[model samples]
Target: MAKLLMDLTPLSYSPALRRIWLGGIFSTVGYSITGVAISLEIYALTSSAAAVGAVGLVALVPLVLGGLYGGVIADTYDRRKVALAATLSMWVLTALMAAHSWLNIHSVWVLYALIAAESLFQPINQAARGAIIPRLVKPRLLPAANTLMMSVGTLGMSLGPILGGVLVATLGYQLTYSINVLAMTVGIWALYRLPAMKPEGTAEQPRRGGLSSIAEGLRFVRGNQVVGMSFLVDLLGMFFAQARPIIPALAALSFGGGEIGAGFLLAAGPIGALTGIAFSGFLKDLSRQGRFLTLSYAGWGLGFTAFGLIAWVFDGQGQGASVRESLLRLSLAGLALAFMGWADALGGVYRSTIIQTAAPDHIRGRMQGLFIITVVGGPQLGTAGVGFAAEAMGAPLTAVMGGALVIITIALATVRVPALWRYVPEPVPDTRQIPSV
Candidate 1:
């Protein structure tokens, strides 16, 4: 209804954005490679959804813990150092994972421990990444920047599973994990090239208590209804509807075999997301971003419902449908997930824009830190929830239930927090002054 796209006349580009974007591309590829390898490795060894779920839970503590302290550190110290340290720590974890796999030490406990430690550091890196964006790109170009980031990430997501599948199926887990370690080292080198980013205002006096620092961030978000609602919607949608953690189990029982099938199925959503981001250049003039955010949540809910229904179709196709059927069904599910991904990208763009425009510079790092927590925590929560449900009710029901929850929660949000639909930022003029991708 709105014009499908506006002309790209006013957009400008940046060296800072390009460097950061390239670094993000490399980091994401490394992250995606490791994600697929580790997930497949654990599933291959234990073959239990609950055991797989343990990985999510193990990461949960450290992820949240890191986010809490990471925010404090981001605000109190040089953000570049905090991010670099966390990035280096993840490289170490990848090296440990490589060593463990190569030595034939297949202990699930050790894998969990190493992954949890890595997960903890991950959020610190994430917080820094979030804080860095405002500095690299101008406000008017934020949506385009988010789209670019998503596009690059989608590229990584597309490659991770495909490459991880090839490596795991042909070369084994050791080689797959080793590749991630090497990739992460490259990411570290890129990270080292980044300039230091200090907090925007006079450094807040070093706070003594962790809880106090964290509470300050909470207070900032809570006082702003728009930012608060945006986070709530994202948390509710993702925590309920994200279905990746259970994909391996679904592949084994409902589809066929493991590893390869699982990897393909897992790669579907992000590939779809990649497609959405690629065309997002068209959405530069879109308005009513709050409404877009709500609709995107609704769309994600509907996509989840479609995912559940398609499983039935895939199941009914019988054995003859194996190759063609899997591809078709996976494509449909991927399309559905891609829609969800688009919604997420739109919401993310709007949310980031709102936070940047509204929040004071002094507290931006702390604010972004809490935002990182929400973003990371949601999927982890979804993973654990879906994992448990898959173990109890099986994959289809888990999908259905999660879908239903997302829809229901969003419906409630639409009515109860009616302000979310009304929230909109002042429109930026297309001007030579604004920075571009």
Candidate 2:
């Protein structure tokens, strides 16, 4: 029973790691609150879902640019400094957002401009912080540490939005934004306490943190089969298997459950993620991480495929019997989504552990940056692709096709990049070997 529970090895191993993890969760909750407030505030101002959606559009370019360049910055300077700078910038931005709300400045464009700035700095902070984690813990514990950090962050993402909706509804946006500012202080302190984490290669290489360096990072990933496949595989997995955007359509047209049903389907994924994270203790012993990751990701596609099949087979159960039919349908659909979320979270844990263990320290910032870019971009593309497909073939076929493609793509990748399938890791951070120039 103990072996099946969530691993606490990393937390018990290092007090600093635990502090940073808790601080990160606090900051994540705060940002999530601001995220919901921003969306709601924009909707109120423009009364256009499209206008509200433009918030992502505003952040898109900056997210890529920051993610790339921010990695360069992290590699070039003291990572703690980079994190501190970004955190302070974010703090001021949150304060300004509060000021905007308190002063009742109802301009949508103003909101767009603020969101754009915030988007840029956010990635810089993320890149620096991600780069710092490997320096704090042994390579063997990376998976456990990541599980703790990611699960809490995911928890915050799940709870924060609901809390944000409540706060925005009752206490108003100004106060909510202020609370975000306050929430950041702990993270700020965490970053401040972190020791200097300059890229180890900086001393010997003395390379400029410029476009050339960024290109070099890109070339390394392209040339390195294992690391490269990690990114590519993750993109493909998320690209083909993501199911969030199709939930509303499935709820209404397929299940006949309307808004209430949609709400249950929506919460299903997060609940599954939390449950899986809680019982991820067995993951610490897995040696063939690549195969584990591949299998978990495959489960994600299967779960979505199951969801579509169940919804299509039931087809308007809510309209027929109301009680037994609806209960049975909601349970099935919810179970499928819950399964999807579990698979997604477990795959992510392995993916992160792979990158952190596989990559060298000096270039880890850039690798982590590329990860952030994939994280931001992959789901957006996946959702857009799925939404278009759903419009044409309806829920059942679209999901099945999407899941099929995900499975096929991964199988092909394992064939091409056999190194990924055979990969294993040493138990400690490899500091003796320098990165290739």
Candidate 3:
């Protein structure tokens, strides 16, 4: 275990890794702000939970479309260029959002339209960013590197909501949008500093638009039971079990706290994630990655269940609770959320490591693209499903039921899909000897 973790230390400061991390940090911060900006915008305009969910639905289509096509693009182009182009598009979108806010367009559909356009490029950005990591650090450090990435991402995710609220409350939406633009500039600069990267797999010679490459990636995933199962677990857990979109409802209605309270609840998960990353060094030596993954999934579901039940208890008190009572309930909810964050982060590292270590270099980009789809798709599916369930059954019930389902599903998956449990970590190759260019 100690040896596995030590591998991360050396790679942490490798020049290429440093460059990528710096850029990723900036971009992540901007992404963090997006939810707050969009939600507040919708809430201010319509004050409807369903309306806010529409923002996610709008982005969902483009995200899926981009992830599918983006893989082909990544496989076909210079990776740096692919990333650069996506970053540029994001920059344009941010600027446009700022302009729309400043002009007081107040057109809800307009915001959705721009977000949808931006989402199309996001998959490419994510795939390119992920694909670049292994090249930057050795395989042994992959888990650690991913942990670092998650740490930065969680920090950004945490900060985005908090800051977005403050920015919206103080500077207004235009200013908040402006800050996202600035963050994009910083992201672009970081990407600029990175050296050009070539795809690892056989560069599929672009031949009159064929499905062979896509089939090949699918075939690769299918052939590897571990990777296949990892993807499915993550997708299912996130899509069906995630309860994040319900926080606002809990805060506003169930818990008697409003927007600020909701932000705190949303931030709680990332806080747990940050904590998990802090101890990521310990994960390096654990050969029982599969076991860790299954446990993490189960843990995540359990946490959500706890949170939902707590919300139900608070709701049952029937709306006249004291300020202190409300605060206590919210605090407990945050704690439960924090647990969910940690579980998800741990599982994420396990699954990602499996994908990176198992896939051949030539097809890594394509696999990553598929991975991006599952990654984004699961949450979007969750957003839609959770939103509907919450609307129909109410937040507390929705959360509790969702949580219970996730736990059961993961537990059943482990027993039924023994492949996930029996999996072992592959030997981390020593890449120190790979001569620098």
lDDT of 2 by residue, 204-302 (tens): 886774788789889988887877877877788788866655665565556654434544565577668878888988888888877777877788888
- The regions of model 1 sitting more than 4 angstroms off are 1-12, 203-209, 316-325, 428-437
Q: Candidate 1, residues 1-437: lDDT per residue as tens digits?
A: 22333222222466655666666676677778778877777777888787776677778888888888887777777778888899988888888988999899998899989988988888788777667666666666666666666566777887788778767888998888888777776667766777888866545466556788888888877887777888888888888887677776666555543566667777777776665655565566666777887777777777887777767566534233343546656667667666666666655656666666556555667777777677878788788887877789777777877888998987898788776788756665654232210
Estimate candidate 3's alpha-carbon lDDT, on a 0 to 1 scale: 0.76
Residue 136 CA displacement from its true place in model 3, Å? 1.1
Report how far residue 39 has shifted in candidate 1, in Å.
1.6
lDDT of each: 0.72, 0.77, 0.76
List CA RMSD, all candidates.
Answer: 3.5, 4.1, 3.3
Give the clashing residue pairs of candidate 3, or none.
1-285, 200-361, 200-362, 201-361, 201-362
Error of 3 at 431 (Å): 3.9
The residue pairs found clashing in candidate 1 are 12-436
Top-lDDT candidate index = 2
> CA lDDT of 20 in candidate 2?
86
Kindly report the root-mean-square deviation of model 2 from the true structure over all alpha carbons: 4.1
TM-score of each: 0.90, 0.83, 0.92
- Sort the candidates on TM-score, descending order: 3, 1, 2
Best prediction by TM-score: 3
Looking at model 2, the pairs that clash are none
Candidate 1 residue 107 C-alpha distance from true site, Å: 1.5
